[model samples]
Target: MTLLLAGVTLVSAFGSSFQYGYNVSVINSPAVFMQEFYNETYFDRNGIPMESSFQKLLWSLTVSMFPLGGFFGSLMVGPLVNKCGRKGTLLINNIFSIVPAILMGTSKVAKTFEVIILSRIIVGICAGLSSNVVPMYLGEMSPKNLRGAVGVVPQLFITIGILIAQILGLSNILGNLEGWPVLLGLTGIPAVVELLLLPFFPESPRYLLIQKGNEEQARQALKRLRGWDDVDDEIKEMCREDQSEKLDGRLSVFNLCTFQALRWQLISIIVMMMGQQLSGVNAIFYYTDEIFKSAGVNENNVQYVTVGIGAVNVFMTCVAVFIIESLGRRLLLLAGFGICCVSCAVLTMALNLQATVSWMQYLSIACVIAYIIGHAIGASPIPFVMITEMFLQSSRPAAFMVGGSVHWLSNFTVGLVFLYMVEGLGAYCFLVFCAICLVTFIYIFIIVPETKGKTFMEINQSMAKRNKVEIQMDKEKLNDFQTAAETPKKKEEAHSTSVL
Candidate 1:
C-alpha cells in the first residue's frame, strides 16, 4: 500500500473508530467516582443523599445512553453518507465528538452529572457514525487486493483506543476523582486531528463514480489512492455495478427492509451485528473490574488486571490484522466464536469453583483472556467488513443503517441488563453468551461465505444461492449483450478475409 493510503487509514481510525473502544472502557474504571459525583450532586440539590437503588438506576442510564445514541446515529447513516459522501460524513461527525468532550470535561466543575450523561450520548452518536462510515470509506478507497487488511484497521485502532483508555484510567493516571473528567474529555483530541488532516485526502472513488456519476473525478481519486493511473479495471467494475443498480437509485432504509433480492444479505448483516454485540464481548469490557473481582482477584489489583485484559485485546486484534487476509473471513469467525464458546463454558466452571478450588481463580482469569483472543481475532472486525462487502453501492448505506441499528440496540440491551444478569444468574451469565457464540458459530458455518478476495458483485453472486434468487442472471445477460454486439464485427472480418 502507498503511504497515502496508510496515512488515511491511520488518521481515520484514530479519529473515528478509536472513540468507540475508548468510551466503552473508560467508564469502567471511573465508575465509583462518577456514581459518587452523582450522589453528591443529588444531595446538594435536594438537601439529602440519593437512594442506592436510584443511584444504580441513574448509572445504568448513563452507561446505556451511549448505545441508545448509537442507535439514533445508525438511523442517520443512510441519509448522511448518501448526501454528504463518506469522507464528508466522517468530517461532519467530529462535531458530535468535540462538543461533547468540552461538556464532559467541565461536567465536574459545573457539578452536574447530567452533563456527563448527555455527553456520553453525543459521543455515542459520533462512535455510531464512525463505526459504520470508516469501514465503508476504507472499503471504497482500497484496491481490491488490500480491502480486507485496510478494513481491519478500524478494529485495530478501536482495540488500541481501549488499551489507551485502560492505561490512562489507572489509579496513578486519570481513574481517580480529579482526573476522570479529563479522561472523558480526551476523546475529542483525535477528532481534532482528523478534522485537520482528513480534508487533504481524496473522497472514495467508488462513491464519486457510482453515486455522483463523475467519471473523471473518480479516476483522479482512484489514481491517487492506487498510486497509479491504471485503475480502468476497478472503474469498469464500479460502472457495471452502478449500471446494474441504476434503477434502484439509492435505497432508503424502508426499501432495504421490503426488498426481496437483498433479503438474505439484510438478514446476514443483522445476525452478524446482533451476534457481535449480544455475544457478551462488550459486557466484558464494561464490567471487567467486577468480573475479575468476582473471580477473586484482589480489589487493589483489579485495575491493573483490567488493563492487562485491554492489552490482550489489542494484541489479538493486531494479530488478526495480519492474518485476516490469509485465513479468510469465514474460518476466522468460526474459530473466534468456537474459542469463545468453549472459553465461556470454562469461565463459568472456573468462576463457580473458585472458592472451592484455589487455582480456579487463575483459571477464570485465563479463560477471560482466552475469550478476548477469540473475540479479537474474528468476532470484532469481520462483521464490519462484511457489511461493506455484502451489499451493492445503492443499497450499501441502507444496509449499514440496518446492521448498525441492530448492533447498537443489542449493545444497549446488553449494557442495560448485564448488571442485573450478574446479580440474578451469577456464574450462569456467561453461559448465555456461550449459547450466543455457539448459535453464531453454527449460523456462520452454514450460511456465511468466504469474502476475503471477492468484489461486491462477486460476494452478492455467492449469496444468491442461499437467498434462492437468480441475481447472477443480470451479469449473464450483460455478457450475452456484449457477445451479440461483437458478432457482426467478426462476420465483417471473415468476409474480408474470404474476398482477399
Candidate 2:
C-alpha cells in the first residue's frame, strides 16, 4: 500500500513537472516564429513593417499575458483545491491545458494572433492551477522524511520539460513557423495522462482529516499511506491537532481583515517569490537568443545554444532534488542565492568590459548558465515548498493563493520589463538582479526556518514559537481548559471512594 501510494505521488509529481515544462517551453523556440507570424499577419495587413519598439511591446505582451492569466488561475486554485481535493483539482486543470493547446495549435495554423493570445492565456491559467496545487499536494502526501525530495520532483520535471522543449524547438524538423503549433499542442499529452491517472490516487489524508472532518476516511487513507492497519495512534494525534484549533471559517483573508500570522506568512512568501523573479531567471529563459545575439553569437545558431541553457537548468534541478533532502532547504537556498549573486555580478562586469576583450561573450554565457544552475537548486523549489509547508491545513490554501499570485505577478513584471531593461539599462540590469540576490540571501538566512524531516504540525508549532507573547497566551489558554476539564473528574472519583 505504501508502494502504491508512492507510485501515485511519483506519477502526479511528474505530471505537474510536465505541465511546468510544457507551459514554459512552448514559448522558447517560438519567439522568432511568433514574431514573423505577427509581422506577416498583422503588420503587413497595414502595409507597414512594425517598428522595433512596437515589436518589442507585442512580444512582451504575448509573454506577459500568460502570467497574468496565471494570476487568476492561482487565485481560483486555493478555493478549488480546498473544496474539490487535490486529485480533482489537478484533473480539472488538465482540461484547461487540453482546450488551450488545441486552440493555440489551431490558431497558429490558421494565422490568428488573437486566438494564439487567448489560447496562451488559457494554458497559463492551467499552469497556474497546477503550480499551486502540485506543491501543496506533494507536501501533504509525502512522508515527513521524504517531503523535501518529493516536493523537489516538480521542479526537476519542470526543468526536464524545459530542456525537452528547447531540444525539440531546435530540431530542424520541428523548428519552423509551422512547427510552433505542434510544440504548443504537445503539452496536451501530459495533461491528458495526468487527468486519466489522478482519479485512481488517494486524496491527502491530512487534508481530509483537517478540512473535511472525516476521521474514518482520513484513517483509511492513512492506512494506505503507511501500509499498515495499526494507525490508530497516528490518526488520534492528527485529530487532536485538528480539534485543538477552532473551525473558525474566519481563517480566510476575506473574513479576517487582520490576521498577523497569515499576514507574515503571505509577506514572507511574496518576498521569496518576488526575489526569485527579480533574480532575472526568466530574462535568461525568455531572451537567451537576444542575449546571445548581443554577445556576438551568430543569430542563426542562437536557438541551438538556448537548448544548452535548458539542459543546464534540468541537470541542476536534478542535483537539487538529491541535496534538498540531505543538505537541507535553508542551506541550499543560501548556496543558490550566493552563486546567482556572484554570477550576475560577473555578467555585469563582463558586459561593461565588452570593448576590451572577446572573451566577455563567453563569460556572459557562463554567467547565465551559472544563474540557471543556481536557480534550479535554490529559488526554484524552496519558495513553493516553504509556502505550502508554512501554513496549517485551514490557512494553507489561502497562503498558496497569495504566494502564487505574487509569483505570477512578479513573473509578468519581469517578462514585460526585461526587453526594455536590456535595451535601456544595458549591462546595469545584471547588476540590479545581483543586488536582489544578495538581499534574498540575507532574508532567507534570518527569516526562513529549516523544515527538513519535520511534520507539518511540527513546523507550525515552531513558527508559533517565534512570537513568544502569542505562544504564551495560547499555551495558557490550552492549560486552563485542561485543568478545568480534569477538576470535575477528580472530584467525582474522590466522592466515589469516600462512599465505598
Candidate 3:
C-alpha cells in the first residue's frame, strides 16, 4: 500500500512537472526564433521595423506573464483545495492544462501570437494551481517517517521538468520558429495522462479526518497508506489530537494572525520563500539565454548552453533527494547558500573584467552553473519541505497558501525586473543577490529548527512551548501587578488559574 501511494503521488507530481518544464523550455529555444518571427511577420505586417528595445520589452513580457498568471492562480488554490479536496482540485487543474495546449498548438500552426500568449496565461494558471496543491497534498499524505522524502518529490519533478525542457529545447528537430508552438503544446500530454490516471489515488487522510470530519474514510485511507490491516489504534490517536480544542481555531486566518506559533511559522515561510527568490535562481533559469549571451557565448549557441544549465539543475536536485534524508535540511541550506555567495562574487568579478579577457566570459558561465548547482542542493527543496513541515494539520493548507503566494510573487518580480536590471545595473545585480544570500544564511542559522524525524504535532508543540515560555516571562515583568500579587488571596487565585 505504501508503494501504491508513492506511485500515485509520483505520477500526479510528474504531470505537474511536465507542465513546468514546457513553460520554462518554450522560451529557452524559441527566444531567437520569436525575435526573428516578430521582425519578419508581426512587425513587417504592421509596417514597423523592429527596435531592439521594443523587442526586449516584448520578450520580457512574454516570460513575465506566466508568473503573473501563477500569482493569481496560486491565490485561487487555497479556497479550491479547502472545498474540493486535493484529488478533485487536481482533476480540474488538469483540464486547464489540456485546453491551452490544444488552443496554442492549433493557433500557432496558423501563426497567431494572440493565441500563443493566451494559451500561456491559461497554462500558467494550471501550473500555479499544481504548485500550490501538489506539495501540500504530498506532505499531508505521507507518514511522518517518510514525509520529508515524499515532499521532495515535487521539487524533484520540477527539476525533472527542467531537464525535459532543456533537452527538448536543445533538440535540433524542434529548434525552429514553428517548433516553439509544438513544444509549448506538448506540456498538455502529462495533464491528459493524469486526468486519465489519478482517479484511483485515495484522498489525503489528514484532510479527510480534519477538514471533512469523515473518520471512517480517513481510517481507510490511512490503512491503505500504511499497509496495515488494522488501524484502530492509529485512528484513535488521530481522533484524540482532533478533539483538542487547540486544533480547532488554528485554521482560521484570524487565529493565524493572533497566535504566536502561527505568526512565527508564517514569518519563517515568507522569509524562506523570499530567500529562494532573491537568490536569483529563477532569474538564471528563465533568462539563461540572456545570461549566456552576456558571457560572450555566440547568440546561436545560447539555447544549447541553457540546456546545460537545466541538466545541472536536474542532476543536482537528484543529489538533493538522496542527501535530504541523511545529511538533513539545515546543513544543505547552509552549504548551498555558502556556495551561492561565492559563485555570485566570482560572477560579479568576471563581469567587471569582461573587457580585458575573453576567458572571463567562460568564468562567468562557470559561476552561474555553480550557483544553480548550489540552489538545487539546498534552497529549492528545503523551503518547500520546511513550509509543509512547520504547520499542524488544521493550519497546513492556509500556511501553504501564504508561502506559495510569496513564492510566486517573488518569481513574478524577478522575471519582470531582471531584464531591466541587466540593462541598467549590469554587474551590480550579482552583488545585490550575493548580499541577500549572506543574510539568508544568517537567518537560517539562527531561527530555522531541525525537523528531521519529528511529527507535525510534535513540531507545533515545540514551537508553542517556546511561545509559552516567552509569554510567561513577559507577564512576570508587571511591577504593579507583582505588588498586588503579594497579597495571599490574589496570589492563590492566580496560582489556581494557572494550574487549571
Full-model lDDT for every candidate: 0.86, 0.76, 0.74
TM-score winner between candidates 2 and 3 = 2
Which RMSD values do the candidates have, in order?
Answer: 5.5, 5.8, 8.8
- CA shift of 43, model 3, Å: 5.9
What is the lDDT, from 0 to 100, of the residue 334 in candidate 1?
92
The TM-scores, one per candidate, come to 0.93, 0.88, 0.86
Best-to-worst lDDT order: 1, 2, 3
Model 1 lDDT per residue over 73-162, tens place:
998998999899999999999999999999999999999999888888999999899999999999988876788889999999999998
Residue 422 of candidate 1: its Cα lDDT? Answer: 89
Worst 10 residues of 2 by lDDT: 491-500
Give the 10-residue window scoring lowest on summed lDDT in candidate 1: 491-500
What lDDT, from 0 to 1, does candidate 1 have? 0.86
lDDT of 2 by residue, 148-204 (tens): 887888887777777788777775856687787787778888887887777877898
Q: Predicted candidate 2: what Cα RMSD to the true structure? A: 5.8
lDDT, residue 45, model 3: 62
* Clash pairs for candidate 3: none
